[model samples]
Target chain A: MNLSRRDALAALAATGVVAGGSVALADDGTDGNVDPADGVPENVIGDDTVAILAAVGSVVYPDATTGIDPFVETYVSGRLSDDPDHRRGVVDAAAELDATARDWFDAPVTELDRSTCDRLLRELGVDAVDPDPEGSLSGRVRFYIVNELLYAFYSSPTGGRLVGIENPVGYPGGTESYRRASMGEETEHGRE
Target chain B: MAGSDRTPAPPADVCIVGAGPAGAIVAARLAEAGHDVVVLDAGPRYEPENRERQLDAHLRPGMEGPWGTGGERDAYTSSGERHYPLNAARVKGIGGSTLHWQAMVMRLHERDFEMDSRHGVGADWPVDYADLRPYYAAAERELGVAGADDNPFAPPREKPFPLPAFPPSHSDSIFAEACEALGLPTHSVPNARNSEPTDDASACVGYGTCKPVCPSGAKYTAERHVARAETAGARVVDRAPVQRLVHDETAVDAAVYATPDGEQHRQEARAVVLACGGVENVRLLLLSASDAYPDGLANSSGLVGRYFMDHCFAGVGGRIDRPTRQNHVGFNTTECHALYDGTDPLAGVKLEFLNYAGPSPAIDALHADEWGDDLLDSLRDSYGTHLAVGGLVEQFPDADNRITLDRSTTDDHGNPVPDVEWSVGPETRRAIERANEVQRAILEELDADIDWIVGPDETGPAYHHMGTTRMGTDPGSSVVAPDCRAHDLDNLWIAGSSVFPTGGGMNPTLTIAALSCRLADRLDRWL
Candidate 1:
C-alpha cells in the first residue's frame, strides 16, 4: 500500500520525531559511529537521515570533485545538533523519502540502487516531499541540503580558484600583494 | 595611561568623555597646549596583536563582535514606531567606530551648511563651510587623506591633499567605462587609508576587509590618535561608562562614571566635553535629570534628543558579459558624483561601486535549489562579473525622527537604553528611486544582465548617525551653539556628528575631526 503524507508523518512521530522539536534517532540497527574529526556529536540524527542527505546532495552537486557524501554528513550532523528546526525538517524528509521508496521500490531509501534513487528523485520534484505543508519541500531541501553544500564549496580555497580570486576573504590565505590598476589616461574632460 | 584600577578621580583642566575620533583629537590638542587633559572611554583597549583574531571573527558569518566588549556578546533593546538596529551600527571602543570604518573621507558640500537658504528645509549651521576650510586642511594632514587634486566635484580648497589618490582597481575600470558611456563623470574617491607607506601606517594591500576590521594598519583608525593623546601627556581611562553629568546652574562641575567592577567615581574639571556618539550623547543628557533641570541636564529647550538623521542607502547589482579579474581590491576606490547636484526635486545622490570579488550572498540565498554542474557554471559566470553599486541619498533632519530613553529596558549598568525612531521621508524615497534608475541604466550601458535591484523601501542602514544635538543660532531649537558648546551651560561642549545641523551627501568623519580641531582652538582661548 502507498504511504499517504499523514502516514509518513505518523511513521516519523512513531520514531520519536516531534513537530517543531528535537529529533531522536530511531535505532534501525545501523551503528552510529562518530568521527571526532568531523566535529559532529554521535547519535544526534539517524544514519539514515545522513544517508538521505548524501544521496540528494550528490545528485544536486554532481560536478563536485570531492563527492557530496562527507559534506552532507558533516553539515547535517552539525545543523541537527545546533538547530531544532533543521533536525525536524531533516528527520521528516528522511521519513517521507523512506515511505515513498517503500511504496515504489518495496525497500528503504538508503537500500535502493543509485540508478533507482536518481530516477526516483527526478520523478519526485524538488518540492514533492515537503513534510510541512506550510513550508516548501524544495526550500527545506535547499536550506538543509543544497545551501549548506554550496556554502561549503564556494567558501573553500578550491571554490575561490574556480572563480579566479586568490585567497578570498574569510579564508586562511594570509596577506596578499597586488599592484593597484589606474583608471586609463585622464582626458581633459576626465577619463574617456 | 589612566590605569583601569579604581583610584580616586583626579581633577583636570579638561575632562573629555568618550575617547573616539572627536575626543581623541580634542584631548591631543588640549594636552599639546599644556592643559591637564583626561579622556575616558566606555570600551576596552585593543592592540595590534588583537587585529588578526578580530578580523577572522568579523569575517565569519554570525560572529561579529558587540559594541563595547572587544569580542564579548552584548545586547540592547529598541522599541518605537520604527525599529532601527542600533547595536549593529555602533561600536564603543577607545578608537570608537573608526576601528571598523572603510575611511572614505570627503568634505561636506558648501550647500550642506546653508540648507535653510538653499533648500527651504532644515536649519543652517551657525558657521559656514569656508569658516571650516582651514581646519579641514589641518584634519586632512593629520589623518593622511589621499585624493586627486584636480577633481572638479570637490569644494574649493586653498591646499591640496597630503597624499596622491590610490590607483584605480579592475572594478574602477569597468565602472569608468560604463560611466563614460552614460555621460557621467567619475572621480577617484578621497580616502583616509594610506596609498603609500608612511611612518605610522602601512599602505593598503587590498585585504578587502575594511568594514569589520582592517588587518593591516593601512586604513586610519582613531586609536592612533588616542595613542598620540597619551603620548602628549593626556591620561586615558578605559571601560569607564559615564552615567550622569554633575552640574550647577551655570556649568557642568564633574562627570560621574561607573567602572566595569561597578564602582562609581567622579572626575572634576573646569570644562567637560561630551564626545560620545550621537545616540549615546542624547541618552546621557536625558538621564541627567536634577532639581535645577527636571527634564534633563541639557533639556532647557526640550530638544535634547531631537532631529536624528541617517543617510538613506540602496544597493543594486547586475552581471556583466565580460569577466574581469577584479575580486579583491580596496573598497570605494572610485565614485561618481554627477547626480550630486541635480535639478530634481529630491536630494542629490552619490553612487559608489562596491568592489568585492565574490557573488552576492543575497543572490546565493535565493538559488538554494540550484546544484551540480548548473550551480558550478552559474557561479563561474556570476563570480567575477558581478558588480554592485550603492547610492547614498541625503536625508533632511526631521524633528519627529528622534531617539528617546526606553525606561523599561536597562543596560547591565541599570541605565535606560536608547530607543531610536527613524524613517525616510518622501523626498528621500523619490531620490532613492531615481538613484536605482540611474544604476540600472549604467548596468545596461555595460551590456550586463540585471540580477536584482533593491529600492528605497528595501534600503539598509548607512550607519552615518547625525543631527541629534544639532548646532544652531537659536538656543530654543538646538542643543549646541556655534562652537558646539551646550546652549544653556557655560562649560559643557560636544564633539562629533551629534552637532551636525545638516548631513551632506558624503561621509562625515573628516568633518567631525575638523570640528573637533576647531573646538580645541576655541577651548584653548576660553580656558
Candidate 2:
C-alpha cells in the first residue's frame, strides 16, 4: 500500500499516458495531452495531473482569491516531494479520478464542466480508488489533494489575514502589539 | 608552564566547555573579574541575522539544510531504550538548547531542595533554596524575567521581577476562570522574555514562534551572554569539540579538542568547567579516561552518568463550546499549581495552558480520512476552540536510567555517541495519571466538549535533562560537591542542570542559570 513515486509513474505508464512537462492549454481551451516519456521536474506534478488538480482545487477552495491550483502545485512540488508516500498517494488518486471521469462522461476530468466536476468529486467520496492498503485510498487522496490545498491556503499570509491574523508564524510581518481586548479585566489575584 | 616551541597555548585562568547559559554566565563573571577565561563550543555562533535565516529555513519544509555547512546543528545520536524522542528535542549551537526553549522561567520550589526531609523520596540538595536565593534574583535580573509580584505559588523572592507579567490572552482568561471555579491555584508563569525593550534586546511583540526560533531578539538566549563575555575579554571558540581532559595525577592540566577540519588542538587551563549539558558532560567525562582514573575523569564514585532524569510530562486537550481567538497571544502565559503540594502519593505537578493556532498535531489521526467540506468543517470547529493543558510532573532520580557510551554508533567526528537508557518508574506513572486526571477535571469543569485525552504515553519530549552528574555532600554517592566542584578533581567544576540532585516540577533553565551564578561566586572566592 505504501506506493513510491516510481511505482505511481509505472502505474501511469501502464495506462499508456505519457508523463510530460508543465501543464499547457490546448487550442480548443481543454487540457493539452503531453508525452509521458518527457521527464517531469522533481516535485512538480505531471501535465495531466496538474489539469486534474486545477479542476479539483476550484471545487475544494471555491472562495480562494488567487485560486488554489497554483498554491497546490507549489506545495506539492516543494513540501510533498519530501514525503514520497504522500506524493504517491496524490498521483494514484489523480489517476483514479481520471479513470472515473472517463468511465462516466467519456472525457478526462479536466475536460468536464465545473458543476459536473464538483458533483463527480462529491459522489466519489470514500468510494474513490485507494492506492495504499494501510491507509484509506480515499483518505490519502483527500490529504494529498484536498487537505494539503487547505493547509497551504490557511497558513499563507493572505489566508491568515482573512482569519484576522496579521502575521502567521512563518510570514514576514513585524511582531504584533500585546492587546488585552476581549480578555476580561484583571482581578486582584491576576485572574480574569 | 612548559616552555616548548610546540606548546599549545598559555593556560587560561578558567576554561569552560560549551557556550550555553551556564558556561556563558561563568565565563562572563570570571572574565569581568579580570580572570583569563576561554569558552569552547562545538557549533557555530549564529548571530541575529543568521538566526532569522535559520528560522525561515526551519519553518519551510524541504529547506532545513541551510543552517550550517555540515550536520553539526544536530550532531548527537540517541540509541538504546529511549522512550521519548530525545535527539529532535536537543539542539547544538552557540546558545545551546536555549535556542529552541520556550523561555518559561520558573524556580524550583523551596521544598524541592529538601525532598528527602519533607516527602521521604529522592535525595536532598546539599545546599538549600536560601543559599541560592541571591543567585536566583541575579539570574532573573540578567534574563529580564517578566512575572507578577503577587503570584502566590512562586518561591519567595527578595526583588520583584524586572518587568510586569504580560497581559493574559483570551485563552489564558478562560483557563484562569476555570481554575478559579475549580478552586485550583493559578498564576502568570514567569518568562525569560522582554515585555518592554531591555537595554540589550527588543521587546517581545508576541511573534508566537519561541520554540524553533525567535525572530525578534526578545527571548533571552546564551548567545547574548556569550557576546558579553567576549566583550569582557573571554576568548570564545566555536566549532571546536572537546575530546578529553589532559591531566596529571593530582590536577587537570589541559583540554584537547578537534576542529571542524579534523585538526586537533590542546588548550591548557588552571581550572576546567564542564558545562556541556547533562548527557554530553557525562559522555565527555567518560571519554576522558586516564591512567590514574581509568574509568573516567571525576568519576571515582562511579556515579558520573548515573541517575539521569527528565521531567515527566503529560498533555490533555479538548474542544471548548465557544470559538476563541486563542492564537493571537503568546504561547505559554498561564499555569496552575493546585496539585504542586506533596500531599498526593505522587509528587508536585505544574500545568501550563498552551495557545496555538489550527491543526493541532494531537488530533492528526482523526483528520486522516476526512476530505473536502468535512475536512474544512473539522478545521473550523476545532482550530481556535482547541485548548491544551500540559503537566510537568516531578521525576525521582533512578541510577538505572543513565547515559552510557554507545560504541556501535559514532558521530561525524568518530566519537562514540551517547546511549540513553531511561524508563519512567511507578511513582512517575502514578504522577502522570494524576496529572491527566487534573487536566481532564479542569476541562470538564469548564464545560469543554471533551474528544480525546492523552497521557504520558502520547506526550512529547520534555527537553529538561538533569541529574547526570548530581551534587551531594558525600563523594561516594555524587559526582560534584555542594559548590559544584568535581569530588575527585581539585580544580574541575561542573555547571548546568547536570549538578541538580532533583528536578522539580518546573523548567530548569532559571535554576541552571542560578546555579551557574553561585558557582561563579564560589570560584571567585576560591581563586
Best by TM-score: 2
| Candidate 1 chain B, run of 10 with poorest lDDT | B66-75
lDDT (10s digit) by residue, model 1, range B26-45: 99899999999988888778
| lDDT tens digits by residue: candidate 2, B235-287 | 88887788888887668888898776658889888899999999889989998
Docking class of 1: incorrect
Fnat computed for model 1: 0.22
Expressed as tens digits, the lDDT of each residue in A1-192 for candidate 1 is 121232222222211233234333444333444535333334477677778866665655534455455545544454355444446666665677677778989987777776677666656655233322235554454445444444444433334445555444533332231123322332335333
- The local lDDT score (0 to 100) that residue B358 gets in candidate 1 is 46
RMSD of each: 10.9, 9.9
Q: Relative to the unseen true structure, what is the C-alpha lDDT of residue B153 in candidate 2, on a scale of 0 to 100?
A: 73
lDDT per residue as tens, model 2, A64-172: 3443455444344444333344455667778887888899889898889867877776676742443232355455555456544544444433344333343345432
